[model samples]
Target: MLKPEIKVLDVQGQYRIHTEFYRSDTAENTIILVNGSMATTASFAQTVKNLHPHLNVVLYDQPYAGKSKPHNQHQKMLTKELEAQMLLELIEHFSANYLMSFSWGGTAALTALACTPRRIEKAVISSFSPLINGPMRDYLERGRRCLADCNRTQVGNLVNDTLGKHLPSLFKRFNFKHVSSLAEHEYAQMHFHIEQVLTCDQPCLLDTASGIEIPVLFINGAWDEYTSASDAQHFVQSIENSQFVRLENTGHFLDMEHKSASHISKAAMLGFLQPAHAEHLAASR
Candidate 1:
């Protein structure tokens, strides 16, 4: 219930990254959270609260996003390579023992771990797609046009259309809700993110999956719009020590699945971060 201590760090000498560190009284391991394009540290409010009782948690705003300041207005778009570098820096700075990343953040986490497996003890990556597929590409283009014109209605419509198509049969049976409207500044940030999505030169995660030796848990919504659950399964299969889980009737933005936050995702995270806790849960059940 209390506010987290906000800290700013200068990484790579130029980029000022905004971060929040929450220390747990229980003295459990630390977990770092990497948010998606549309998310900031605020987005993980519920997940942080759920995990804070047992594990220290760290969440940060990516460069130019959230409260983090960019190097300049004309700075180059974010790439997985850059994200990986930043994450490695943070891992060293905080001595993070685990990583929990969502959406594109997963790509960066995977990249960092593949490059340096010992950086963290384990990782939980959800809804991460290394490359955009045809439908996702079309959705991004449509979102770009809508964002350029500042058409909030169109952007909401596009999200609903895409999410509806990906929601499980139970969700499709009910009337869909409109995606939440973004503030002007948030809209601008999203526009910037879409631009990066358009021009991202990062290679597919499968290319680097083999290099990681740590245990990874890949979570995907059974009917996620951006990336297929099958792709997540394939990713898990590629890694000898990785596991996969598909949350039923869920889509992308698993955090939004519950009004407060994602209980399912948090459970998966707990299982990964505290295997003993997970076994305790299993034994109790």
Candidate 2:
């Protein structure tokens, strides 16, 4: 039910991309789900599987994330704006209609939406604080450190310390194993996995948040030490026609580790993507 539907298309050059369609039979325009840095398309499988079967749900791995092949010269070095640009190429390629982005992917999704301005019906951003600049810059600094000091134990301790501020209950639920895999990533991997961590600009996030005029829905876990609720609030305040949802008892990866939390978040996301899910009734209608 949930797998990467990777297809290689020559839209100018060969592009290998992954897409998960919840209901391939339905002709409805799809809701594109974009992953945060270093995350794969697999993260959204459970969410899309649980969503109303009438809609076309999709999540894809950007160049370096999953099954898609990474091209050193093609990557533009750690920036996925073109990753988003390619998403739009796939959108036109597949004719999708909506989008949802998490963390850094929010920047990419916005580019895809903005380039084809009228195409996206709605977009949802979770655990993201694009319009607010400072925290992300700070986070990126740490990311650079993470790559530089691949001392697993030391880096792990540092990451744990950074996550310490989120309330203990949700913090206990944190997925260290899930993130710990970062330590095992091939050191010789593209960008040394360093290019985007360093070169990718944080203001690109701020500018994207401010630029798009689409109907936006923001999701953040109240205890999310990663992306503060205040920053999410700032974007809601700035972006016209945007709504915010804070899921209780969860940390950063609401869509992954927290089941009920993501279900609750999905209800709001469903409402935001109303026109498609509305066809039924009070039951995801």
Candidate 3:
């Protein structure tokens, strides 16, 4: 087992971000694993173990997630633009060459790509769309309301009813139980993160996608209503060098899928991250 080198980054003295770096001496590239909303560096432990041997892997806690402290405790929400800026800083600091983002992290990654396309060599985004449709908006609202009411059961039910139903059978019960049993801080973080998403400018975010110039691979679950395959496919059309892959029987939580499904998702990502593949993608453009 490779033990990570842990550090806390003080971003312009604005936020204290906790990060873990797994360095592979033989690796020629570094990939940063951006977590979804309310997720911590620990959430990507398995992914880190799988990736570090092939490429250097870095994982971090976004503001208000895990050990990362928010800039202002009184103001729990940070806009996606700010998050993107923070991501850029991390990339520059670590000299990371690639990005792999999941769910909400896709928002930040897209924003970063749009604003500064040349910063990354390649990227793989899973289960995310810049456009928030009606069902997704409603889901976010319901989750926010449930969190505000401290209704853990309703929160669990809401998840099970939406994203959970699409998960593998092995994960359904455990997912509900884990969601319903979130720690106090986790609940607060979720509420604020949902609020951030609900209030963000969707069309503006969507417009930014056209500015991306680097090669990108988008993966979506066939049954993900929140960030539907259709939406992700449509979003990819704006990028000049982007490909979309739809995973059958998968949902929003690609990383949390059952063993076989998870392996497929990881394999697809690893294939995309390969140096030869990236070189071919760049040449095709």
The TM-scores of all predictions, comma-separated, are 0.81, 0.76, 0.85
Winning model by TM-score: 3
**Model 1 residue 8 CA deviation in Å:** 0.7
Ranking the candidates on lDDT from highest down gives 3, 1, 2
Ranking by TM-score: 3, 1, 2
| Candidate 2 residue-wise lDDT at 139 | 55
Model 2: residues >4 Å from true position, as ranges? Answer: 2-6, 10-14, 24-27, 70-76, 131-139, 152-204, 236-238, 275-285
* lDDT scores in order: 0.73, 0.61, 0.79
State the weakest 10-residue window (summed lDDT) of model 1. Answer: 171-180
lDDT of 3 by residue, 1-285 (tens): 888899888874678788888998978889998888756776676677667677999888876666775533525457678888899889988899899998888888888888764558899988888778988989898889889988989988888788667666656776577678766667876787787777778676568788788889999888788898888877755788888888887888865766665766766787787957545544876
lDDT of 1 by residue, 162-281 (tens): 844554444333312223445455556667767876886645457777667788888878768577677676675457888888777678766556543367776777877797987787
Checking candidate 2 for backbone clashes, the offending pairs are: 278-285, 281-285
Clashing pairs in 1: none
Q: What are the RMSDs of all candidates, in order?
A: 4.6, 4.4, 4.2
